[model samples]
Target: MIKDRQLYKLILSILTVIVVAMIGLQLVSSWTQPQAQSQLNLYESDLLLQASTWQETNDAEPGTSPLLENLWGDSDPVQQALKNYQKIKTSATLQSGPTDDPEKRAASEAFVNELDLRLGLLYARSGQVEDAIATWTPLAEAAPSPGNQRAVTAAILQGLWSDPPQLKPQAQQQLESQLKGWFRYQSLSQLYQLQQRQETLTTLRSQEHAAAEKALTRLAAVQVFPAIGGLTGVGILIFWLIQFAVKKRQSLPEAASTAPTIEPIEAQADQTPNTPQELAATVRWPVTTIWQVMVVWFAAFFCVSFVLPVVLYVAGAKPETFGARGQAYLALIQYSLLMGVGFSILYLSLKPFLSQPLKWLPLRWQGSWFSWGLSGYLAALPLVIVISVLNQKLLQNQGGGNPLLEIILNSHDRFSMGLLLFMVAVLAPLFEEILFRGFFLTSLTRYLPMWSAIGLSGLVFAIAHLNLSDILPLTVLGCMLGFVYTRSQNLLASMLLHGLWNSGSFIGLIILGSSVS
Candidate 1:
């Protein structure tokens, strides 16, 4: 960071070019990511399926749950399921034909075919017989060899659901064995109903009833958790209206509490006041030098993010090939390396500029850090929740989200979940706060107004994620993080705030995921 102007400029220029290219690649990667709402739809469909069934012969308290009311909208669970399945049908992939890449074509067609099967069954169950017939008619008539499983399944459905048995008597016998899975289990009760086999239908319906009870119980947990969190957020909002941001008295350094004034950043290095105003209150590192450090920071960021996957790929450790636990563990290692390499380079870059430079960005454990963090957490929840709901509506779940969230949702076992929690709640907060809030926001304050610095750093933090759909919500969350650190002047406070936010997301996703699974 402290070097000859021409030499520094040359290095910075090269880094700038490389970073631009990396950013472009990241943009394409984000934009072109396959839409995975099918996963979410599948989960929600299960909950809705059970809820609709559970409401019958149970004292279901729909009127008592206003929070879940919005989730299901004005429609019954059957209608909501229908709508979810229909949305996926509309956006189903590879409607034209298989893609150029055989593997991609296979994956896309499988996904679309699954959606079609689900939508058709949902239609039949809801008594939209004509719709079901329309949807499955093509599948039943299509060339069986290409999609042998789906074709046979639809043909079987056609035979059972038609006015008279539509199957060639021998054809159903040949194909029925191929329909072996949860898919087959789900269709059994429906098939019994079609056949008017009262005894078998009654037995299968009883099994369904018991399974639906378990599902609704899980839904209750998932529903109750968010409602409680939202209410806590609302309570905090009310308290915040009466008292905003950490009070002036709480913001002052402990050393400055006895005095009305404290030293500013530009104060002379040799003149140490009895009380300090901020970290690095005496060191007068030039704003220009800080800007150089920022460049080095981003250069390392781009290199690690862009190149690490390639390195891992060449090492035969493709992330996508891993299961939940394996992927989570690999992510932990990746994050550790990122902080290790990025910080080492950052420290070396800054060492020449200011002596004991690490002191400038201290994570002091003193003062009301917990309070500040809690306030930020409370404020962040409702605000982010509102934005997220709107974000889904506006984006229609199109812009890709963090791949990590998906991993967290699917991490079923305790060891894997703990690994993810450690990475997200502990490691991520410490590393990211140091880089974004400790260094970047602190540096920006020298050139811009405090609030302006916070906002700009927040925007950068969001953009760093390389996700368009989440940018706005993450930006809002980031600004609250910056605000806490700036007001409290303690890195630990921001870390706490960050950890809580991510932990909350992890918990909520896991709850939804576990229930759905």
Candidate 2:
């Protein structure tokens, strides 16, 4: 009894360690995020105030204050502030820095362009409209981000139209350039917006199609129907475990948990139980061959779930015609039904054929409900943040991460947020945990060292998320989940942990939105 208890305790402790490590990783990642914008913000604010002060007076004589006099001399404070702003402007010129990551380099160029826009805004406000227009003209050309270019060009045009005719001919031409630029800029902006909308519609349609196909596939693929199969499988496992426990009690003079002088008869019997390895032997065959039954069911499920929708999509069915609310309900029903079918098939097919008793599937309570859910969630939160930072900094810095995809996918709009929430807080953790912690870790541990199993599973999980940019973070998360699952031999525990990690991300998104304003 003591030895068995010790072994269980050891497993629990290891699981605890894995959870703690993951949390620590998250905290560290959150701590290391750069505050570049925040650091520059105050300086920019002070500069803006100085410019405002300068613009307040256009006098040639220096002010009475020594600091203002020394800084502006006999020149107007507004002109001097503008000159200083121009100097900052020159320093802010877009330049290729030491970066292998094309995305990061592109981000840097965008940042420089933004600085130029800021300078232009100040110049325009201070009545240097021509100068402001001139400055913004190159930026609109250089970066050419539809959104930014539109804003800058609009500002430029406003400055140009607001300017007096006394401004030089060159300034007048610059104003004309701004006008000409608007023609190309407006068209490009509209085109980009249209393309974005079309892409979103396409993705939504594909997701709906996939969901429908999956639902139908579930219905058809059954070797055995899900509802009955799962219950029966669970019942059978419970029956076997009870029989084993009973037999052991009858034959043994003492408890199985206790160290006995002799091996129990039931234990000895169970070591060579009357369980067949083959499906044929396991399920009395001939009338219902397992393989044939499974294949037919799967084919039916696939045809209904996958093939039909694909055919419809290929035939040019318009999902929008169905309405968004209707489509959402359809998707929900399809997913829920598919899940039910999967669970049913899983319980019946795999559990029934396996030689081991079903004691493993029982929902063993770990701690208080709150502790189990909330503490586990708290433990997993750091893992998400860590993975994100590592993906951004390490993989991204090396010029290997998919920055452009990140930028496009990460647009802070409704569709982008929805997808981001779904990917990070839903699809990723669920599918990833099942593959790495549940499947790969289980298989690897059967043949290799525990650490090796954990490490390999983590690596596979990272790669599967599909971008080199995510490698570091996903791998780390994978390792954490694998280790926790392996150590506890509790798939439920890790699943909870993974779910909590995703929830934390969802919460973080909320926090991020709140912070942005």
Candidate 3:
């Protein structure tokens, strides 16, 4: 037994060392997290353009209300899109750097060239031909060569737009021979169409009016469900407010705390024999050991800090190389493994008392679990949204968000969507609620006030995500989740609430991602 205890200490010490390194990894990786602002900008621009189109079409009628346009204020989506592009241009310029690897250096150069190419198109389309020329000039100055397709294309572009239309004889031939493709929105054929002469914005707008209408139709189609959801939330809030007033604020009161024993065996109170047991098969063991907590932490952080990095390094995988569907599959597998490992560790620590019970956690489905979860979700909407809007402004689209948002947004196929929904809505809620509310908060409640325990657990939950941008809002969200779980005495209630919250976000990202694409 002493030997076993020493071995446990050795394991714990190693985990402590790993935890220190994991903390460092979190801090370093946080800086490189994908920003949410760029995606928001695109979605917002599309929404504005569609709204503007609707306003123009209806304004011709005698009594058309300006309600929609008024709500969004004086925003010109086209200009907003242009400004966003300029910001992107500036950001890409800042990130450009020297590289020692030939492939990396070539990739960097190609990226810059592509950005310039696309930006030049935007400039020309906006009737700034001079700006376009300037944009393409750096690439254009490079000597036309077989390997330098971008330079050759740039030279050809300059020849088409130059005042006197001067060019080497081989320049035109080089573009056709060397360059094959570019961005979907801008390419060689697109430039060629603009070659002979510049078209006025008025003429181009007329040409794109049909496409704009189609985009608007799509935008409106995708937004209908969310509009209904928001309205439903508002209705639910109103009903709850009425109940609060009529019942003197006890309409949805918190449930009585049911914290269990967490003392050492010798210090514990005697229990009745009527307790459920089958030869100690159903013993309720307190998973409150420091070692147990350390193991749980180790499982999570060790995977993130060491396992993930090693796997990616060995596989030579980079974030850019991943598609949404691929990431979804990976997330499903990784989280399944993580949660399985954590629960297994906790279960095994019970040793002689180990046994599978009907209910592993404080999840009671026989009562008002469903209603509690739904109410919590609805009540949470307005407050969470207000904070979220302010959070977005405070962040100014700079702080990183969950990479899953970006991944799920870009995915639409049935299999990938299902995988994502299951992982997020089902898997995440089950594991997180079981760990945080079922174990952590309940254990804390044995010592602290219910509210205090909830608050601390909520804070920890928010920080666990490792997103600075999400910390405040998620803290609020986590508190609501904890409150719901505590009141219902059902882990399922909190899991449902968590699932609904994530499911809502998932839908929104999908709509925005689909519309933008």
The top-ranked prediction according to TM-score is 1
Model 1 alpha-carbon drift over 4 Å, by segment? 1-3, 34-42, 57-73, 93-99, 165-186, 194-203, 242-283, 305-309, 312-320, 410-413
Instruction: Give lDDT tens digits, candidate 1, residues 107-170.
Output: 7666676667667777777788778778878877776674477777777776666776564444
> Clashing pairs in model 3?
none
| Superposed Cα RMSD, model 2 | 20.0
Question: lDDT for each of the candidates?
Answer: 0.68, 0.44, 0.63
For model 3, the superposed segments whose C-alpha errors exceed 4 Å read 1-14, 43-72, 91-129, 139-214, 221-291, 294-297, 304-328, 350-360, 388-399, 405-413
How many clashes (backbone N, Cα, C below 3 Å) per candidate?
A: 0, 12, 0
Position 201, candidate 3: lDDT: 34
Native-referenced Cα lDDT, model 2: 0.44
Cα displacement (Å) at residue 313, model 3? 7.6
Which tens-of-lDDT digit does each residue in 390-426 have in candidate 2? Answer: 5444432322332222222224455544544555455
Model 1 pairs in collision: none
Instruction: Please write out the lDDT profile of model 3 over residues 1-517, one tens digit for every residue.
Output: 9999789778777876777566556645664433565556556555555445544444366236454444344655445556766776565455445557788667657766866765665566567889889988988886556467777677666665567665545654565454322222233334435454246333434434444455555555445545556567678878867877988865333223333453223212222111111111222454345346645665575665458657876889864676777777777777787887767665565443423322445655578889989888877776677787788667554456786776766667778888988888988999888777766765565545567778888987887777667777888899989878876767788999999999887776776666543
Q: Show where candidate 2 strays beyond 4 Å.
A: 1-135, 139-153, 157-312, 315-352, 355-362, 367-390, 397-435, 513-517
Predicted structure with the largest lDDT when compared to the true one:
1
Q: What TM-scores do the predictions have?
A: 0.82, 0.41, 0.70
Q: Lowest-scoring 10 consecutive residues by lDDT in candidate 2?
A: 273-282
Question: What alpha-carbon RMSD in Å does predicted model 3 have with respect to the real structure?
Answer: 6.8
